[model samples]
Target chain A: MNEYNSLLINLSVFIGLLLIGYFVGGIVEKRHFKSILEREEKLLYFPVINLAPRRLVEIGEDLQIENCFFVSGLVVIGEDYFKRILGFLANFFGGRLLSHESLLDRARREAILRLKEKAISQGADMVVNLQLQYLSINKETDSQNANNSVEIMAYGTALKVK
Target chain B: MFITNIDYVPSLKIIEHYGLVSGSTVRAKHIGKDFLASLKNLVGGEIKGYTELLEEARDEAIDRMILQAEDFGANAIVNVRFSTASVAQGAAEIYVYGTALKVS
Candidate 1:
């Protein structure tokens, strides 16, 4: 009877935590997506390119080349409890982990946006030769309960055209 | 000193070259911050602590690289590149490398 009661208690705690994660984590994720959308809209005009322009003279009339410098932005994003729970299950089944995928997507986009902002703040007409890198800060524990943190970085050269 | 990812500087000409200058650092997460991060992971958003950690590491590595370039009597570091790796559990390595050049 005692053993059964203990098991029941543990199960309840697990369910209770999951319920909290479901509601609270959902709200957080929604709010984050909304912010990302709004910020992206605000930053639409900050042009970023992956290739260096063939000729600087061919750039728009407004830009007169002055100087160029390097810029970078880094963002570290973590998954919510709800996503963690989903990831745990996905690990068991061995397939694409969508929960972690969305987390990385958000991180990558956010990092790029921040990089653009940095370039703009440096009086850059535009950013070129863009690059991105990602890292995961996952704890080494038993397979089931291990947690992972994802980080992304975006970098480029900002041209200060006068 | 000027630093850029591009090999060629539009205005400045490379007078001399100093091969490759590089720096790297490995960092381990603290237990306290790890616990806090796990808690923050529950509701999910940016982990400020880890972000700061990575930024600091990167800056340190870059600073070290600059120090090396200065020792080599270079005026600038070009083709600057950054890389990170997971050396061990709860630990990460940040590396920065570039070609040192004297420009005029």
Candidate 2:
């Protein structure tokens, strides 16, 4: 009977934590995604879209001289976010926020913007072959520390419609 | 070279010195090769993020530049140079350019 009661207690805790994590992930991850979209909308001037459904006919205006540039930089997200992720992970057994995928995804989005800025400064009308790169600074030794960070970059040509 | 693929397209120009050409895009063996290169870097290794992308992009950019020359009726493209950027860890950009010629 004692053994069964202990088993029941452990099971209950596991389920409770799983439920809590999912809720946290839903909130935090959604916020990250939304902010990234907002940033992109404000920055790049070209008619580019994220993974732009098809690689055809981007719509925009006025033929301008094609220009190109490349941009890059690094940044860190504070421990507050980091702690939240950790806290969720510590509680998680299943059902939500399984990994740090959402966090990484947002970083990629921002890095691309840096590259776009570099291209735009060159007075490019559009960018082509756009790409993203990342270097995880906090994956290990610094994982949970506030100082942990990563580098993010996006680059492509700025072109003017000919 | 300027892209003529845009709406207000222009006809290909053939130069006496240079031969028939419209525009060319360079194809690279290393599509996402940079990612591999970074792995090679390991801990304390120099980051060569822009190497692959820049190399490929330069070639493509150059091919396009030459094509642009053809469109302008230039016989040859001269003074080609390449510029590169390590936009981020996994991404790179390359641009190439040169003077268009129509030598008599």
Per-prediction TM-score: 0.91, 0.37
Candidate 2 local accuracy as lDDT?
Answer: 0.44
Please list the residue runs of candidate 2 whose C-alpha ends up more than 4 Å from where it truly belongs after superposition. Answer: A1-38, A49-67, A78-95, A98-102, A141-150, B1-104
Error of 2 at A147 (Å): 7.0
Model 2 Cα shift for residue B17 (angstroms): 21
Question: Per candidate, chain B TM-score?
Answer: 0.96, 0.49
Q: C-alpha displacement of A104 in model 1, angstroms?
A: 1.1
* lDDT for position B17 in model 2: 41
Candidate 1's displacement at residue A30, Å, is 1.3
lDDT of 2 by residue, B16-58 (tens): 4443343333333243544443332221112244333333454
In order, how many clashes per candidate? Answer: 0, 8
Model 1 Cα lDDT, one tens digit per residue, B54-94: 88888899899999999999989988888888888889898
Best by DockQ: 1
lDDT of 1 at B86: 80
Across A34-116, the per-residue lDDT of candidate 1 in tens digits comes to: 88899899989888887664444466544455788888899988777778888878767988887777788888888988888
lDDT per residue for candidate 2 within A121-153, as digits (tens), equals 656555544545443322333243222233444
Q: Point to the candidate with the largest TM-score.
A: 1
